[model samples]
Target: MKLLEVKNLIKHFPVKNHKGQVVHAVDDVSFHINEGETLGLVGESGCGKSTCARTIIRIYDPTGGEIIFDGQNLATLSQRELKPIRKNMQMIFQDPYTSLNGRMTVRDIIAEPLIAHKIGNSQKERHEMVAQMLKQVGLNTEHGTRYAHEFSGGQRQRIGIARALILKPKLVICDEPISALDVSIQAQIINLLTEFQQKEKLTYLFIAHDLSVVEYISDHVGVMYLGKLVELSESKELYKNPLHPYTQGLLASIPALDIHAGKITDKAEMSGDLPSPISLPSGCRFCGRCPYAKKICAEAEPPMKEAAPGHMVACYLYS
Candidate 1:
């Protein structure tokens, strides 16, 4: 079952000074997340990974597109109409330090969702729910009495997890949830998320810059370049054989240890910086930096097409 379907998702921010020009943060991006599966979205910074998540969750009004969640068109729902839908969906933010409330106690932070949704019958009931959630996320009940600032980065993220899962939401959007933590703690957090997903039958849309991390957690992976999805495939298939140039570059960039030879190899290096979203190229957004760009690539954009079994790529090379 498709839990969430985003079709032709377009999100644009108006240029500050330009009258009609807009920043194409996300344009014509499409993907879907199946029930109890993870869809990992990977992209370089400023490629609109976070913007896409935000718009799908209705944090920002989309410029155009369809956001269908649980068979309902969330893009057309009013704020009041979205209240119940919000209860079934939750997000764990990227920064543990900034995402949690420093002023509020851990108990309060975790209870906010329950309070907003009126899940508990009374204050005592809510506290019990929070305590159970704290334990589930690998934190102790006693820790709930302390403020968010009192915990380490990993612990703080655990609190964020507790908050998100308190509602028992069917869909969770993990927006780079493990990026800011210590390297040693990253695995632990991922393991915790995995455990919860299995236990709760959760569907996740995980966004991250780390390809390895996404591969570990995602069932399917989508590659984004300059606000467009360049490629998408099964996680294992994508790692074994990346179809798009941008996806190949990303996989190559991952640091690998060569114990026998004592050196790394197979890094597909590219030249040039990312172009500004406001003044994008006329044809392919990635043509500016793609090493194999041809005259045709500069003259016409390529549509995303199936390259292999369940593998999608948008490139003139495949077209």
Candidate 2:
């Protein structure tokens, strides 16, 4: 069953004092995540990865397109209509330090969702629920009485995870949940999320720039560049053979150790910064930085086409 299906989703931020000028944050991107599946969205900073996730979860209202989740079109729903639906979907924001409330105790933070949705009958019951969730996320129940400021970065993140999962949401959008953590702590959080997914039969839309981490957790992976999906395929397939030039560039940039050569192989073959979203290129968004650009690439945008079974790419070379 498809838990979430985003079709031609668009989100644009208007430019200040510039009539008719808008930042194309997300443009006509489409993808889907089946129940109990994970889809990892990857790209450099400001590639609209987070914006896409935010739009789907209704943090920012989409400018256009459909947000179909659990057989309903959320794009058309109003705030009142969406309140009930919001419980089925939750988001783990990027910054753990800011995502949680400093004033609220850990118990109150985890129980907020339950209180909002009216999950428990009394305060004692909700406290018990929060305590259990704390233990599940590897936090001590005694810590629930403490404020978020008192915890370490990893411990704070664990609290955030507990709060997100306390409701047992059907779909969770993890927006770089571990990027701010220490390298050693990243794996523990990832492992915890994976374990929860297996036990709860949860579905996820995991967004991250770490290709290795994405490959490990995602069933399917989508590569975004300049607000467009340049490539998408099964995790192994996409890693083995990245079709889009942007995708290729991203994969090539991943550091690989060469023990025999006695040097770390880290080469970012693609050059040049991203073009201004205010005045985007007439054709492909990545044309300016693409090494394999053709004349037509600057004249017309390439449509996403399936180059092989279950592998999709947006490039004139594929067409």
Which residue pairs of candidate 1 clash? none
True-vs-predicted CA distance for residue 316, candidate 1, Å: 1.0
lDDT of 1 by residue, 108-213 (tens): 9999999988899999999999999998988899998999999999999999999999999999999999999998999999999999999999999999999889
Q: Give residue 147's error in model 2 in angstroms.
A: 0.4
Give Cα distance to truth, residue 144, candidate 1, Å.
1.3
What lDDT does candidate 2 reach at residue 130? 95
Q: lDDT winner among the candidates? A: 2
RMSD of 2: 1.8
lDDT of 1 at 65: 96
Report residue 142 deviation for candidate 2 (angstroms). 0.6
TM-score of every candidate relative to the true structure: 0.97, 0.97
Candidate 2: give the clashing pairs.
none
* Candidate 2 similarity to native, TM-score: 0.97
Off by over 4 Å in 2: 259-268
List CA RMSD, all candidates.
Answer: 1.5, 1.8
